[model samples]
Target: MARVMRDATVAATAEKIFAACGPSWLGDSYNHWSAAVKAWAVGATRSLPDDDRRAIVYKTQELDDALMAARRALEEEDDE
Candidate 1:
């Protein structure tokens, strides 16, 4: 289905963006990248069916959580 395909693409994109952030990028830069990815994914997912949209939304949320975790780790590293 179209929804499935859309979700798959979004998932892959989110993973790549998150991976690119890596451990070296932190704070404002990390936040900026994550925000941009989230916005883009959300915009792309909007056209999907409700069920498909929901899956994409959850992945977005998970990405957000990962970004926060990554940010926190970066901050902690900075503190040390």
Candidate 2:
């Protein structure tokens, strides 16, 4: 059951990531998508009996931070 939940979360996250970043896609904007995905992942993780929520939350935060940093770098370049 834990494995199943993990797999589902991964699949869902991948789908959302692609929708947010892929070309020719029609989904939520990147900011909204990120927030929504984080919320959904946290809610889903809460259902697990084991202590996997910390890992998920950590990874999500890492991803968001990395993306924000990259975006800032790109914006700075664009302004130059």
Candidate 3:
């Protein structure tokens, strides 16, 4: 039963995540799964426990930070 519940959760998460990826960003290698997963994490689950929400938020921040770094690096390359 626990296994079945876990599988259901995974399926639901995947569906929610799939709904998140859209309006395509420029110059991105669109991996639908990654975007969907991120969206699922930051979406309706906002009502989860503080620790869970915080973890998701932190993950989002980390991804944002990485993207900013990548963009800066690209800009520097363009300048050179």
Candidate with the greatest lDDT versus the true structure: 1
Please list the C-alpha lDDT of all candidates, in the order they appear.
Answer: 0.58, 0.51, 0.46
Model 1 residue 36 CA deviation in Å: 11
Estimate, for each residue in 1-80, the C-alpha lDDT of model 1 and write its tens digit.
Answer: 44555656768865665565543243344445545555555666355454554454456557766767877899999999
Task: Kindly provide the TM-score of model 3 when superposed on the true structure, using C-alpha atoms.
Answer: 0.45
Q: How does model 2 score by TM-score?
A: 0.44
Which parts of model 3 are misplaced by more than 4 Å? 1-47
lDDT of 1 at 14: 54
Model 2, 1-80: lDDT tens digits are 24434745654555565445443222324454445555566656356433344434344444555666787799999999
Q: What is the C-alpha RMSD, rounded to one decimal, of candidate 1?
A: 6.6
lDDT of 2: 0.51
Higher-ranked by TM-score: 1 or 2: 1
Better of 1 and 2 by lDDT: 1
Clashes of 1: 0
Q: Candidates ranked by TM-score, best first?
A: 1, 3, 2
Q: Candidate 1, residue 70: CA error in Å?
A: 0.7
* Weakest lDDT window of 10 consecutive positions for candidate 2: 21-30
Candidate 1: the clashing residue pairs are: none
